[model samples]
Target: MPELLNSRVETCFQQAEAFFNRPFKRAQVSLKLRGQKAGVAHLHENLLRFNPQLYRENREDFLKQTVAHEVAHLVAHQLFGDSIAPHGEEWQLIMRGVYELPPLRCHNYAVKRRSVTRYIYRCPCDGSDFAFSAQRHGLVHQGRRYLCRRCRHTLVFSGETRVE
Candidate 1:
């Protein structure tokens, strides 16, 4: 894990402890490529399965948001048994009171964004342009070829460009 992520996790843990009025035992945190969109939480097993891509991709806001979401789940389970509603009013209150986060909302993890340039492409037909931060977009249906949905044209991958 990155140093920044480690710090965020620690901060989240402290915040959760303060809200719960109890000390939280050490727990494991790891980054995953994809996780269930339901919410972030402490997983007893398969810690790496917890997707950090959300936080890694959107470092600024997501790091805190995801940490808060997972911390809420841990706190809820600790206070109330699993019988309580996963997303009940109590959870919402904890999210705000403990983590100082807004109400829960849907998160779209599939949205692609550009950070540093790993690859560049241009649409052959309409001259549209696209850039990818990662080596691959993970869309392998057509063997690394991406067709422009709008123009229905093949995208030609150009060599990497240095982005500063």
Candidate 2:
């Protein structure tokens, strides 16, 4: 399953390399199937993260659609740079022209959510607007910091602190 996922991802990269006339060396990327997000592209670090659980449960769709979606982000970033909107025209073009897939911004997967303590967190941009997922909250507890994607401000926990 891992090999198959890597192959599909590599194929997308190769196509992008050929189309854009730029190289995305195999060694530069670190692909892993471990994350809460279905798929994420870290353009600065050249990392591609996918959720293995989601992939195993939805193999067909994951390979066909999710794979294309994540790879499109990398291709878009490489071709158009990070200044372009994450899912804007540049990404849509890659989805349609390169991967022959729809430019959908989000996925619909029935990922079960466990009832864990939700810690209230807010960034100045968000203004008392959000709660962290159990996994993310755990990370925060472990001293991992997260910044708001919108305003780039650090998130502050609103609830009382408790040591686990």
Candidate 3:
């Protein structure tokens, strides 16, 4: 079924073929590339990445639009060159004119949100409190200090907050 998505990309590549009247290589779909984003296209690498989480949640759109979206980026890069702006006229043309898909800048998939534990910290200067993500909290627990940009004072961990 993954290959089915690649076939969709090949269909999009063929559209680029007719549009530019030149050869366009097919883009491959990668499930291993994880990100908060729904998809990404590496024009130089000839690769397309779909967030596996997004893929699982919205397989229909993932197949229908995500492949075409990323393929349009590659086709736009081939026609317009690296200096061209991403999601500019060239990409939009391939997206809308060629693929017949909406020239949307991003997707609206419902990705799963993980519960995060935040550490609350305060600066002594003004008694202002700030929340730190788990990664930042780990750094603080490792004896790293974060300074307040406004007060120029080291922020100390005051408490913890769980975000769901």
Candidate 4:
């Protein structure tokens, strides 16, 4: 599987080089990623990290979209430098024009539910609730304001927690 992923990544780099008429460094690949994300690209390190569990569950999508997505990040960074957004116009161009794939920001693979403690938050509109992970809850303490997607209102801590 790793060899296949490496081949897919190299193929994308080759495609990008041909499309842009320039050479791109081969990205280092790892299967160390975990949690909800399908993959991530470390632009500075020229690294691609894939969620091995997710890949095992959604093999085809991982090979097709995930590989291209991470490669596009490395390609865009090598071309446009670090000032551009992670999924900005440059990355989108690489995805569409170079790889000929949709510039999808996220994957829809079914993720395994992990045991986690969730901090409860509430939105004023309709008084809907949200469960925030400890990391995000800590960010809120550091002055990160979270908004409810459905109501578009600020989420306030309900002073509750859940273990699941």
Candidate 5:
């Protein structure tokens, strides 16, 4: 990561902790330069993704605001569970009281959205297809290779495929 990008990621985590009045011990922050339409708060796998282009274009103001936005979601879920409304009154209060951000509003950026691609694999002998979350897919020998249970054939990881 570039210096600016690393700084932004660290700053976002720091701001989030300060705003929540509680430190997030195990949370991880990451940047995705092209996944804006995927939303700002992706909580699965304990990761948060911020659009680098959006942060760069807006600089400090946008960085602080979005960090608050995503942190609100994380805090809310940790407290009240994931079924709660993402941007409801509880979230709004956290944004204000904890983060000291202005009143919440639906904010959108005009950046061009890019499609995410996933990798696909197949078993050469049995013709079983396997889909993976990452673009670069490979199989390691130390671990048990995902075999076609039905055909007992070794799986081969293929290449990336555009989903969009």
Candidate 6:
């Protein structure tokens, strides 16, 4: 599986190199990624991380789409620099023109999410409750305010918390 993934990544890089008319260094692939993300491209480090579980479950799609998707990120960064958006026109162009693949922003794999504690916040408009993760909850503690999109009102803690 690893060898196949490596080969696919190399093939993508070769396509990118030929299309962009520049040498692209081979990117390091790691299967250390967990959770929902199928893969991530660390542009600055020229590294790609793939979720082993997701890859094993969806091997063909992961190879054909996900590999090209991530490689496009690196190729786009190298050709257009960091000023361009991560999934901007440059990336879409590479996916369509170079690899002839769709420029999909995310994978649709069914991933199991680990249960975590959630902090509940409420919107003033209609008392709709919103659950926030620990990271966002901490950000709120540090005086960061989040607004409710529908109501256009600031979120306030409802003194509720849950673990599920």
Pairs in steric clash, model 4 = none
- Tens digit of per-residue lDDT, candidate 3, span 33-113: 665788899889988887877877888888888888888888888777999889898888888888788888888877667
Measured by TM-score, the strongest candidate is 3
Candidate 5 residue lDDT tens string, 1-164: 44664564565556667765677644566676364532366555666676667777776666566666776776666656777787887777777776778645655666765665666668887666777655234334345466777777766767546475
lDDT of 4 by residue, 18-78 (tens): 9989999987788999999999999888888999999989989889999999999999999
lDDT of each: 0.65, 0.78, 0.82, 0.91, 0.63, 0.93
List per-candidate RMSD values in Å: 8.2, 9.3, 3.0, 7.4, 8.0, 5.9
Index of the highest-lDDT prediction: 6
Minimum summed lDDT over a 10-residue window in model 1 is located at 42-51
How many pairs of residues in model 5 come into backbone collision? 0
Angstrom error at residue 43, model 4:
0.9
What is the per-residue lDDT of model 1 for residues 1-164, given as tens digits with 9 covering 90 to 100? 78877777678778878767787655567665554452456444413224555666667766667666766666666677667776787778888888888857566556554446555677877776687655554453348777898887777776646573
- Shift of residue 28 alpha carbon in model 5, Å: 1.4
TM for every model, in the order presented, reads 0.57, 0.65, 0.77, 0.71, 0.53, 0.70
Q: Could you tell which candidate, 1 or 3, scores higher by TM-score?
A: 3
- What residue pairs clash in candidate 2, if any at all? none
Global lDDT for candidate 3? 0.82
Tell me how candidate 6 scores on lDDT: 0.93
Count of clashing pairs, candidate 2? 0
Which structure is stronger by lDDT: 1 or 3? 3
Alpha-carbon runs more than 4 Å astray in model 5: 2-22, 33-39, 103-105, 113-164
Tens-digit lDDT track of model 6 for 20-75: 78899888899999988999999999999999999999999999999999999998
Give the Å error, residue 38, model 3.
1.3
**Candidate 6 — worst ten consecutive residues by lDDT sum?**
17-26
